[model samples]
Target: MAPSRWDRLPGGRLLGGLLALGLLAGCGHDAVRRAPPRSASTRAWPTVAPADPASANAVLMRALGLVGTPYRYGGNTPEGGFDCSGLVNYVYRDMLDLRLPRSSRDLAAMQGPRIPEDRLATADLVFFGSAGAVSHVGIYVGEGRFVHAPSTGGTVRLDRLDGPYWRDHYSGAKRVLH
Candidate 1:
């Protein structure tokens, strides 16, 4: 038979055949193996159950949409701008109809499960502080990132949780949404 179309392409016949074979081989029951669970000491961070996707997505979308809105101390609404906690408050309230404490310190002390850094899910509140006093807060938006209104002359923005200043000041996180 004449060389097939796949054979006409450089290495296509051989590569395609090999890829097909590999995929077929991987379908066998024994082809899959789960890695052994890591011991607590060896684990980098603990995991937690994910938050409700609908609520989390709504909160995240609302928070992200406000990015670049100017920061105003004690401001809460989009029209008025926002402070750190005010941004968080507006997001949760706007998206989930959930009222939260207006100040970061109060929000930190509000009732909720404290989530570790690695366990944070979308919409979880990440806190920052010094001398054991919680002073700033932001909404966790997955991928070690968060959204907040940073400071005077700044605007709502996304920042990395692992950033030097944030990492050093990270007090803890709290899950307000189930």
Candidate 2:
């Protein structure tokens, strides 16, 4: 029998072979690099921009179009429904041609620097409190509000960031579009 195509990747087989040695090597330094977030406001993905609110507003409006759509876990389209992260993922993709992580954990890990809460722009990402960890995220709209899928009974809407629930659990914010 001939070797399969999977065997052609240079390091694929050799990578697995090194697992036992990697464990024995005690990769503690790298382990610490993956430490759990300790604060509510950790970081927001940082990037350079020329300060464009018009683009931001257009993106926010596009996101608002999907409000009142049903919430379907793991959904990523308006035809079916959307969860929190799914909504953000779709909006950024559709409006600004940007892609976002599919889950809140991956989204949260994207933090680099924080944008001021009051200065929110379109296509910015906002993190909400986790039940036990980061369980929710949304796209920020202007005026201290954000559009999100929220929970079981709620439809996506522009919510005040200072609300007791969101305020207490505001993890951080990031700008990803424009």
Candidate 3:
């Protein structure tokens, strides 16, 4: 039998290992390390739990209240701040006690009814990325707006889905509440 694909390359195993290490190293440097502290007004919004845990509206409300929270790599709490996925994870956990995958890519693959952009409702998770990879997520809040912890030096903020940046990077959306 002809050698398998792996045997066709010179030092294939070693090359693959180096590529993996390079990718992992690149990931750590993507997020900004430090940002200005949260402003006092950022603390004004109250994170009130909604009366109904399963309601999408309730989840949206909770998510909106988190606007202005700082962004931190791998952070999942308001105190330490939250990354995009962290913000989504925290809100769902708080509102419905539903534990979601920790990464944006995993959340995109989660088993929920897929929602087309036109049908997206409040609390639906909107995804964004390039090269067919899901790298960012946000919670839909209506009026074509979504809330998220954007990036280093950026805090949770509401952004329009129609905005050039979001519109261009739009991959798809998923409704997690249902």
Output the number of the lDDT-best candidate. Answer: 1
lDDT of every model, 2 decimals: 0.86, 0.74, 0.82
Candidate 3 or 1, higher TM-score:
1
Clashing pairs in 3: none
Best by TM-score: 1
Tens digits of lDDT, candidate 1, 34-132: 545654334343334465888888888999999999999999999999999989888888787888888999999998789877788888899999999
- lDDT minimum window of 10 residues, candidate 2: 41-50
Q: For candidate 1, list the clashing residue pairs, or say none.
A: none
**lDDT over C-alpha atoms for residue 34 of model 2:** 79
Q: Which stretches of candidate 3 lie over 4 Å from their true place?
A: 1-54
Better of 1 and 2 by lDDT: 1
How many angstroms is residue 115 displaced in model 1 relative to the true structure, after the best TM-score fit?
Answer: 0.5
Worst 10 residues of 1 by lDDT: 39-48
Q: What is the lDDT of residue 18 in candidate 3?
A: 81
